[model samples]
Target: MAELKRKVLTLSSGKQIRLYGNSVAISRSLEIGEGYAPNILSGNNEQPGNTSAGVINPYKLTPDELMELADFNIQLWMDLKANIRRFGVSSPRIFTGESGKQPTETTGNKKTGLSSRQQATE
Candidate 1:
C-alpha cells in the first residue's frame, strides 16, 4: 500500500478542514458511476408582488433544490467525521522488535510462535 498522506484546508473563518484517505473513499462511493445521469436542480423566476407595481422578483429554486442542498450538506458532514476518525490519530503499536527480526516472528524456519495459519508447513 502507498503511504497515506493528509490534506488540511483552512477556511476564511479560521476553521481547519482535514481530509484523509477515507474522505476520498467515501466520495468515490457516493459518485454516480458510468451510465448514470446526474440530477440538476431546477429554478424559475418568480414575481411575488403585483406586476402593475413594477416590481420584478428574483429567481427561486423548487422544492427539489432545497432537498438536494440539505442532503449534500448532511453527506459532507458525515464524510468529514468519518475521515477524521479513520486517520486523524496515530494507531497504537501492537509489537516491537530489534532491527534484524520481524516483530511478529522469532527463531526458527518453523515460523516460531506464529499462529497456525501464519506458519509455513513443510
Candidate 2:
C-alpha cells in the first residue's frame, strides 16, 4: 500500500503536531478523472479581484503589492511540496448499467484515516 511521509505542522497555538502516515491526501481520480469539473474553491485565477471565494481585497493594496502576495504564495506551495511525499487517490465505486456508463450513485469521498468503504471492509 502507498504511504504518506510523515511531517510536522505548526498550529496557531504554537504547537507542533506530526501529520501521521494516515493523513489523507488529495484524490486525483475524483479531482481530474474521466468526469470531473473543478470546484469553485480551486485556486486557479488568483489575481487582485480574481479569487475563487469572493471579490474582496481587504488590504486594498496597490497593484505593486501583488508581487509580495505572489511571493507568499510561492513560499507556501514550496513548503507543502517539500514536506508532503505521498498523495492519496480515490477510486470511486461507479455503478454501471447496460450502456456501460452511469451517474455516480456512490463515490468514495472521505477525510483522513480509513475510507467509508474501507471501514466497512474492516
Candidate 3:
C-alpha cells in the first residue's frame, strides 16, 4: 500500500508549505518530465524549458521552490544510489518485501537472516 506522509518545508522567507509523501515525489518526476537540470552551469542562456510534467502536478510548490525541491530530490537519489552500490544491494526489495514473498527467501531464513543493511542509517 502507498503510505501518505507529510513534510513541513520552511522557505527562505519563513513561510511554510506542507509537502506530502516523506519528501515530494513530485520533485524527481518533475525534474525528468519537466526537463529540469539539477545542476545548472554558469553562463547558460536557457533555464529549463518546460515547467510541466504531463502526468504529475506539483501541488503547492512555487516555481522557485520547485527548482529547489528538484535539487533536494536529486541529491537524495544520488546519495542512495551510491550507498546501494557500496553496499551491493542488488535486490533491496527482496529484503524489504513488496506484494509477495521473494522467490529465494525461505520462511526460516527470512526470520533468522541478519543483513548488514539493518545496521546502516541515513
Candidate 4:
C-alpha cells in the first residue's frame, strides 16, 4: 500500500505547518509517498504562498487520553438525546467494556498457586 504524504505550508512569519493528505494525482507517470518534506518548491511563482492567519494548533493525545475523551463524547450524546427524542431521535447504546469471571484453579494447581504460597509462608 502507498503511504500518505504530509503537506507542508510555510507562513509569512516563518512558522511551518504540516498536514497529511489522503492522495494527490500527478499525471499517470509519477507518484510520491506520504511524509513531511521540508522544502516544497513552487511551480510558477518565485515565492511560496503564505499560510492562513487564523490556523489553530492541532490536538495531540495519547491512546488512553483519547479513550477517555470518547467516553465523555458518548456521555454528551446521551445528554443530547433528551432534546431530540420527540422528533424520533433514539439514544444509541454505547458499551464501554466487558466483565469476565476471574480465573481460579480447583485441583493441585490451586495449592501451588502464588496466593497459596503467600498464605503458607505467613
Candidate 5:
C-alpha cells in the first residue's frame, strides 16, 4: 500500500498527535463503534462519560469557567474532525454550483416549468 500523508496537531500541553487521511480515520471510528456495540448489545447503556475517558476536573469551576471549558472541548473536537481528511471536504472538484446566480421566477405555462396542479390537469 502507498504511504498515507499525515498532519501533526500540537496540543496546548506541548503534546503532538498525528492526524491521518480517510483510511485510518474511518478505521479508527469504526473500531470505536464496534467497541460500543458490544456494550450496547449487552444492555450496558451507560454513556461514556468524561471520567470514563480519564478526564477529571479537580476544581469547582465557575459558570464562566465551565463555559470556557465547554467551548474548548467543542473546538478541539471540531478541529480533530476537520483535520480527518474523509470527514472534511475530500476534493475541490465537487462544485456546489455557480456562485452569485439568482433564481428566476417561473410561470406554470410551459411543460418543464409547470406547477404540480397544472401538470396534473394536463
Candidate 6:
C-alpha cells in the first residue's frame, strides 16, 4: 500500500501537529453536493451591474454567510487531511501567505509530492 501524504503544522501556541492526506475522508467531507457550486469571491467585477435604477440584486451570501462558509470549508479540509488524528481548529489562516514564496502552479503527484515541472527540471 502506498503511504499517505503528510504535513506538519505549527500552532500559535508553539505546538506542532501532524496531518495526513486521506483520500476517502477528503472525498466524503469535501465533495460538493449536486447542483450547488459556490463561486470564489473575487475582486474583479466581471458581471457588470444594470445601469437602470431599481434593479434588485441577485442571491448572494451576506458577509456573515461568506465568513461562515469560508471557516467551515477550511476546517473541513483540515479534518479530512488529518482524518487519522483529528485536529479541529479555526485558524488555518496561519498558513496563508506566511511564506513569501509564490505558490507553485504546476500539478504534483499526491503520493510522491513532486510537481510535473519539478520532475521535468530534475
The lDDT of each candidate is 0.41, 0.42, 0.43, 0.39, 0.41, 0.47
How do all models score by TM-score? 0.27, 0.23, 0.27, 0.22, 0.24, 0.28
Give lDDT tens digits, candidate 4, residues 1-122.
22333465555666655557432322111122343332322123334674433322245456677689667645544534432453333322221112312123222336555465465566
Worst 10 residues of 1 by lDDT: 30-39
Any runs in candidate 2 off by more than 4 Å, and if so which?
Answer: 1-58, 86-122
Could you tell me how far off, in angstroms, the CA of residue 80 lies in candidate 1 after the best superposition? 0.3
Q: Summarize candidate 3's per-residue lDDT along 1-63 as a digit string, tens digits.
A: 223234565656667655532333322222212222324322233448755433234254467
Candidate 1's TM-score reads 0.27
lDDT of 2 by residue, 8-91 (tens): 545566665555432333222222112123331223465577546543455565667867865754654443443343221232
lDDT of 1 at 21: 23
RMSD of each: 15.3, 17.4, 15.6, 19.9, 17.5, 17.1
Q: Candidate 2 vs candidate 4: which has greater TM-score?
A: 2
Cα distance off (Å), candidate 6, residue 17: 25
- Those runs of model 1 whose alpha carbons end farther than 4 Å from true positions after fitting are 1-58, 89-122
Q: Evaluated with TM-score, which candidate comes out highest?
A: 6
Score residue 84 of candidate 6 by CA lDDT: 30
Model 5: how far residue 67 lies from native, Å: 0.6
Score candidate 5 by lDDT: 0.41
Q: List the residue pairs that clash in candidate 2.
A: none
Please identify model 6 stretches exceeding 4 Å from their true place.
Answer: 1-28, 31-57, 84-122
**Least accurate stretch of 10 residues (summed lDDT) in model 2?**
27-36
Best by lDDT: 6
If both were scored by lDDT, which would come out higher, candidate 2 or candidate 5? 2
